[model samples]
Target: MKFGDMELYILSDGTLTEDGGGIFEYYPKNIWASYEVDGMTPYRTDEHNNILAAANCLLIRHPEGNVLVETGVHDKTLNYVKYHNIVKNPSLMESMKSAGFKPSDIDIVINSHLNPDHVGWNTVIEDGRLKPTFENAKYVIQKKEFRKAMDPGFELKNDYFSAEEDVLPLEGSGTLELVEGEKEIFPGISVIPTPGHTSGHQSVMIRAERTMLYAADMAALVMHQEKPRCKMAFDALGREECWRTKKKLLYDRAAENSWYTYFYHETSFSVGIIHKITNTRGEMEGRVEKVEIL
Candidate 1:
C-alpha cells in the first residue's frame, strides 16, 4: 500500500514459527498460562510451549529510492519444516514484483537489529557467492549493533554471526552506513534507539504530518503491546526494560492520538492506530485498528 508518496509493501522471504513458552521464558509460568483459552491460544505454541511467529519484512519506497525495513529468512538452511503448513513457500522476488518493485530497484536496506530473522535476506547465495540482495542500496545498521555482532565471544550463534559474510562484506564494498542513536537516514526516515531486545536494537520512525512507527521487535504482537510487562524469552537484557520500552511506546503513541504503529510480527499487512476506550469499571482499554497497508 502507498502512504502519501511512500509506497509500502510486505516482502516475505519466509516465516518462522516458534513455541510460545520459548517466547516468554522470562515471564512466570502462571502469568503466561493465564493467557491461554479454549484449545487454541492467541500465542503460537508447539506441543510443549508457546511461540511467536516472525512475519515477513516491510518494504518502503519513496521517490528518492527504496528502503527495506527488515530482510526475512534467506534460504532453506534455517528450519522450515514446522512452519511448512502455515507459511507459504517464500519468494521475496515474487513478493516484490507483486508490489511493483525489483531487487535492483531498492536503494536503502535497513537492519533494525542483527537478529537472524531480521537480517536473513541481507545476503543471497548467487552461484555459491553470498552477496548483498539489494545491489545498489547502502545497508544501514547501528554502529553498536554491528560491533556486538562482530564480537567473537558473543554466545548466541543463531543471533549473531560473522561480519565477513553477513555485514562486513557490505562495508568492504563501501555499501554500509553505521549510524549512531536517533539519526536520520532519510528525509522522513529516522532510527530511534530501543535497546533491551539487543544492545543496539533500534526502531524505525517515519515522519510526516502524521507519523508511522515501524516498531521492529519493540512490540512483537498485539498482546505484547497490550501487556507491556510481558517479556520475550529471547530478550538479551531481561524483561523489565523491554516492558518499560514497550509501555512507553504504547502510552506515548496513544497520548499522541496521531501516530500509526506497525509491528514486524503483526498479523495484518497494514498500519495500525491505537485507541483508548473506558470500560464499564472506568478502566482504559487500548484497541488497535489497522488503518492502511502503508
Candidate 2:
C-alpha cells in the first residue's frame, strides 16, 4: 500500500448490491456475468440479475493530513442489498477506527460523485438532524458536479444525490469546497473531470513520488478497466463522454506505464497498473495487471 513515500489503504464502509443489469447498462447480462471479479464475494445475482458489490473507500495518509475517498451506502439502503443476500459490514467510522483512525481524524473527503454509495458518510443522521461526520475535514467535489446535482432534472439522480439528506447538510456545514476542473485539493492530490458517468463526475488523482488516479465508479469493477469502451446503465448524462474519459485515463494517462490506477468499487483488485496492450496488428488498448491488496 506504500507507493514510494506516500501511504495508502482501503477501508470498507461495507458492501451493497446493484442490479448487475443496472450498472452495466449497455452490456447484456450474459456478457457481463461472464466476467468475474476475484476477492469479491462470488457475485450472486437474483431473479432481477442484481449482484452484490463492495464499497471500498480509499484512504491517503499524507503529511498534510489524511484523505478519505468515497464511502459506503447508508444503512437505509440495506434492505435493497440484503434482498439480494449480500451482507453489509461495519460503519465507515468503525472501519476507520479498526484501521487505526477515527471519523474526526480525516482531514479531507473527496467525493468522486454525488452517488449515494460514494457520499453516504458525508453526513449521518444524529439527533434527528443531519450532522457532519468529519467535523474538521473539508469536503471536495467538482463545481460542475455540484451544479448538476442541484438541477431539478437531476431529481432522476435522487438515488445518487439526496438533496435534503446528503447535499444541503454538507453545503451548509461551511466545510464544502467545490473544486474547478483539475484543481488541487491541498497538495499531492488533484481531480480530473470525468463527466460522462454523471454530468460532473470527477476522479481523484494522487501525485507525489508516484501517481494513481482513483477511477471511482468510472470503472465500477475491474472489468471496465479490462475493457475501456464498456458501457454502464447508470451513466445517464454522457455515455460517449464517459467512454472518452475511460480512454483518456486508462489508455492515455495510464499508458506507457506512467501511473497506477485505482478502481473504487472493484471488490477483488481495487488498485493496479493498467498496461496498454498492443495486438499483432499494432492496434492498442488498456487492461489492468498486478492485482494488489485483494
Candidate 3:
C-alpha cells in the first residue's frame, strides 16, 4: 500500500492461537464473543474456544530509509507451549524478499516492546551462535524497555523469556540503538512511548500525507481500538496507563486527525481509520472504518 511516496507492506510471521480467556483476561466470554468490526471478527476460536491471532510486521519503503517494525516470533520461540500452535506463512525473511529486499536492505528495526512474539526475529542462530538477523540495520528500541526486559521483576519475568536470546544478543552485535522518550529514526518515522503492556512499550508513527500509527500491542486488535477500555491480561504491569494511552492515541489523536491506524494482532482489517461515533448511550466511541491507500 502506497501513501504518498511511501510504500508500506505488512509482513506476517504467522498466527498464534491463544486461550481466549487468557488474552481477554477478566472480560466475560459471552460479552467479548459478540464483538465485531466491519462484520468481521479479527479473532477466531476452535472447538476449545481459543483466540487465534496474527503476528504482523510492517515494512516501510521511504526515500529517507527502510524501516521494519515488529520482527514477529521466530521459529525457535515456537517451542514454548503458548506458541505451539503458531503458523508461519511467508516468514519475515521470506516476506521481505517478496518485497524486493533482503535483510541487508533494512535500515532500522523498531520493536514496540521486548515481548517474545514481537522481538523473536531480532536475532537468528548462525554457526550455533545467535546473531542480529538484519546485520546492517540498527535495532532501535526504548532504553527503558531494554532495561526492564533485561532485568524484569518477578511478576513480569515471563514476558521477557526470549529477551536473553533474541534481544540481548543485539547489544553484543553492536546493532542495538536504545533511545529515551520519543525519537525519530527517519525524517517521518518516529517512536513514541505508549506504555500499558510494558512500562517501556512504544509505538511507531509514520508522518506522510496522512499520518500512520502502528499501535503495536497497545491496541493489539480492533476491539481495543474501538473500545479503549478493553485491555488484555498482558497489560497487568500498567493497565490504567495503557487505557489512558489508548484513549489518547486511538480516540483523541488518530480519530481527530483522521490518521490511518494499524493494530499488530488484528487478523482482519488490521489497517483503518478510527472514527468517533456516538453509541446508543450517547457516549463517544471509536469505530474502526476501512481505509484505502493510493
Candidate 4:
C-alpha cells in the first residue's frame, strides 16, 4: 500500500487462534457474529468458536528511514503459546526478511504499548541471554507506558510478563527512547496517545496530503473499529476508556478525515479508510472500507 511518496507493508508476526469468549469478553457472541463488514465476516471461526486473528505489524519505507510499528508475539518458549494453544507463524524477523529488509534496515521501532504480543521482538535470546533484537534501531515508546510496564501492579502483571525480557533490555542497550504524549518520530510519522487498552497505549499516524492511522490494538479487529463497544477480553484494564479512545480516533478523527487506518489484529484485511454512515436506527456509525489510492 503506497501512501503518496511512502510505501506501507503489512507483515504478520503470526496468527493466533483464541476462544471467542476471550476475544469478545462482554460482547455477546451472537450479536457480533451477526454483524458483517461489507458483506464479509471479519473473523474466521472454528467449530469450537475459536477466532483466528493476525498479529499484524506495519513497515513503512519512508524517505527519512525505515520505521516498524508493533512487533508481534516473539516468545515461543513462553508457556502462554502452549497454554493458549497459539499457532505460531513466521516470526517478525522472517517476515521482514521476506519483505527484503533486515534488523539493521529498521531505523526506528514504534511500540504502541508494551503488551507481550506487541513488544515481543524488542529483544532476542542469544548466548542464553536477552538482548536488543534490532541492534541499530532506536526503540521508541511512551514514558508513561514504560513506567507502567516496569511496575504494573499484581493485577496487571500477567499482561506485562515479557517486559523484563523483551523491553527492559532495550534501556540497557541505550536504544530505548521514551517520549511523552504526541511526538513525531519522523517528518511525517507520529505517535499519538490513544490510551484505553493501556494507560499509555498509542497509535501511529503516517501523514501525507491524507493521513493513515495505525489503529494498533485501539481497533484490533475490523468489527471493533466498526462498533467501538464490542471490545476484547484483553481490554479489561480500561474498558470504558477504550471505548472513548475509539470514539475520538475512529469516529471523530479517522472517519472525519477519511484517514487510511490499520488494525493490528485484523486477519483478513488490515489497511483501509474509515467512513461515517447513518444506520437504520438513525445513529452515526463508523465503517472501515477498503479504498484504492490513485
Candidate 5:
C-alpha cells in the first residue's frame, strides 16, 4: 500500500513447507495440541497426522530506491528437504519487473538475519563462484550476526550456507554495511535491534508521519504477535526474551498508531497491522488485519 511518497509491495520468491514441530519445538505437546487454529486452514498432513508449516517474503519500494527485505530460496539450492518443492523461480525478479524494477535497480537489501530462508537470493551461484544477485545494492546486516555466521567452527546446518554465500561475499566486495541498533540505513527506513531469535537478529522500521514496523522473525507468525508468551522452538535466546519483545512491540505499535505491522512468516498477508482490543473479561487482545499489498 502507498504510505506517504513511498510505495510498498509484497513479492513472493515462492513458498517453503516446514513441520509445525520444528517451528514451535519449545511448546509442550499438550499445549500445542490445545492451541486453536483460527481463520486459516492448517496444512494437511500425511497419514501420520503431523502438522505442516510454510512461510513467505516481503519486498518494499520507495521513490529514493528499492529495498528488498528478504530473498526467497533461489532455484538450484532448493534440493534440501527442509524446504519442499523449492526451485529457482523468477517470480521475485518478475514481480519486481512488473512493479517497474530490475534486479540491478534495487538500492538496498536488508536481511533480518543470516537465516537461509531470508538470505537465499543474496547471491546467484554461477560457474562455481558466488556473486551478489542484486549487483548495485548495498547489503545491510547486523554486525554481530555477521560475526556469528563467520565462525569457522560453527555448524553449517540450519541454512548457514547463506552466510558463506550471500552475506560474506558482499562484505568482501565492500557492498555490505553492518549496523547497530536503531541506525538509519535509508531515508525514512531504520534498522532496529530485535535479538532473541538470533544473537544479532533485527527488524526494519519505516517512518513517515506514522510508522511501519517490519517485525521480521521477531514475531514470525500472527500467533506470536497475538500471544506473545508463546515461544518458538527455533529461538536461540530461549523463549522468555522472545516473548517479552513480542508483547512489548505489539503494544508499542498500537500505542503509536503505526501505519502497518508486518511479519515475515505470516501466510495470509505478508503486510498488515495488529490492533489491541479488550475482551469480555476486560483483558487486552491483539487482532490482525491484512493490509492490501500494493
Candidate 6:
C-alpha cells in the first residue's frame, strides 16, 4: 500500500459481535438474518443473534513518524462492549509489534470516534486508574463529537463511550488535540467529517498516488454499501444525517468505483473497490467485491 510518500498498513485489533437488530428498518426477516455475525446464524434470532465485526486499526508510515487510526477495545470497557472479543493474544501490542513498531512508538492517534470498540486501546487500567496507552502519541478528535459525548445522555444510548477510561486519560496526558470540522492531519493524511453514526464521527482520507477513504462507522461494514440503501439499527443518533452521508460516499466513491475504501467493522474483506453488478431484474446494483493489497 505504498502511494506517494505514505505507506498504509491495516493491522488487526481482533473482533466483535453485536446484536442483529443494529441494522436499520425496512429489510425482510430472512434477508436480515444474513446480517447475523456468524455463518451458523444465517437463520439467527433477530433479537439475540449477533453480527461479528472486526476492529481494524490503520497505521500510516511517513518519513516523520507513524500515525495510528483506531485502537481496539480495552478490558475495562468490556462491560460496555460485552460482545467485543480481543482475540489477539495480547491485544494491540502484538499487532503493533508485527507491524514493526511498539505502542510507545506511535507519535499520533486519530480516533475515528469514541465508541468503546474504537478507542479501547487509548488507555490502560493501571492500579485502579486509566493511563495513556501510547505514551508518545497525541490524539486527534472532532470538537463537535467530543462535546456531544461529554454532554449527558441515557446509558442508555450512551454507555458505549467511557470518558474516564478513554478521554480523560488523554486529557490528563495533555496529548488530546481537538480540531474543528475536517482537517488534514499531516502532508498526506486527512480526517473528513462524515457524521451520522455519531454526531461527531469522522472518517480518514489518505491521498497519495491513489485515494483511499477509511469510512469509519459512517459505513461501518462493507455490506452496508452492498444493499440499495445505507441503514443501521444504531443510527438512532443521526438517522437523517447518516443516510445522506452514506449515500454520498456510496455514490461518489463506492458507486463511481474510484476510491479504495475501508470499512471499519468488516471482517471478510476490508479493503476493496466497489463495482456495479447486474441483477436478475436486469438492473444495475452496487456490491463490494473483495480484493487485497499488502
Q: TM-score of model 1 relative to the true fold?
A: 0.84
For candidate 4, what is the lDDT? Answer: 0.82
lDDT tens digits, residue span 66-96, model 6? 9999987655745544555446554677878
Clashing pairs in 1: 19-50, 19-51, 20-50, 20-51, 21-50
lDDT tens readout by residue for model 4, 1-294: 778788988778887766777777788788766667667776646888887777888999999899999878846455878655565577778889998999889999999999887887888889998888888899999999999999999988988888888888888788999999999988899999988788888889889889988888777777777775767777645677887888887888898887888877776677788888788888777788875533
Q: lDDT per prediction? A: 0.68, 0.74, 0.82, 0.82, 0.69, 0.72
Q: Which stretches of candidate 4 lie over 4 Å from their true place?
A: 291-294
Off by over 4 Å in 3: 81-84, 292-294
Worst 10 residues of 2 by lDDT: 35-44
Encode model 3's per-residue lDDT on 1-294: one tens digit a residue.
Answer: 987788899887887777777677777887677677678665556777888788889999889888899998745754673554777786888888887989889889999999888887899889999899999999999999999999998988988888889888898788999999999888888999988888899999889888988988887878777765677887846667887888877778887777889877877766898778878888877788876543
Off by over 4 Å in 2: 36-44, 77-86, 152-155, 279-283
Report how far off residue 183 is in candidate 1 (Å). Answer: 1.6
- Over 135-186, each residue of candidate 2 has an lDDT whose tens digit, in order, gives 8888888888777777737356555546556766888788898988888875
> Candidate 2: deviation at residue 149, Å?
1.8
Give the TM-scores of the predictions, in the order they appear. Answer: 0.84, 0.89, 0.95, 0.93, 0.86, 0.86
**Segments of candidate 6 deviating more than 4 angstroms:** 24-26, 35-47, 81-86, 155-157, 276-285
Using TM-score, rank the candidates from best to worst: 3, 4, 2, 6, 5, 1
Which has the better TM-score: candidate 2, or candidate 3? 3
What would the per-residue lDDT of candidate 5 be over residues 150-247, giving only the tens digit for each residue? 86244435546556766777776767888877788778998888888887888888887778888777777666666545556667777777756766
Candidate 5 residue runs with Cα over 4 Å from true position: 26-38, 42-55, 74-83, 87-90, 152-159, 254-259, 278-283
Off by over 4 Å in 1: 26-44, 48-52, 76-88, 152-154, 161-164, 268-270, 276-286, 292-294
Model 4 Cα displacement at 145 (Å)? 0.9
Clashes of each: 5, 2, 0, 0, 2, 7
Can you give the lDDT of residue 111 in candidate 6? 90
Can you list the residue pairs that collide in candidate 5?
Answer: 26-233, 75-88
